[model samples]
Target: MVSRQNIIRVADFIDSTTRSWRTELILNTFSKDDAQKILQIPLTHIPHDGFLV
Candidate 1:
């Protein structure tokens, strides 16, 4: 399984890219039960560019 810090890092990347604070809130408060849902997201879809890498 991926680490929580890694997930938060992705969330931070998304928040930065979209300038959306909602990502921060979700990352900050996400529960263990929600992790599977987050994992379903394709991190690669954001591109391997520096922004989301």
Candidate 2:
């Protein structure tokens, strides 16, 4: 099961993207993964590239 904090973190990450509509569209195009490793990182560790790499 996904944790509440992880959900919030993912949402914030998505919101921080350049365009919400594009972000949502791209996210929807991909299959969901409960083990999104990046989301497991502490917010402080997120890189400037925004984990797009």
Highest-scoring model, lDDT: 1
Off by over 4 Å in 1: 1-29, 45-53
Residue-wise lDDT of candidate 2 within 1-53, one digit each (tens)? 33334554444444344323223433444445633443344444244544543
Model 2 ranges with Cα > 4 A deviation: 1-21, 34-53
lDDT tens digits, residue span 14-46, model 1: 544554334434555577567546645654434
After TM-score superposition, the amount by which residue 43's alpha carbon in candidate 2 deviates from its true location, in angstroms, is 15
Q: Could you tell me which residue pairs clash in candidate 2?
A: none
lDDT of 2 at 31: 49
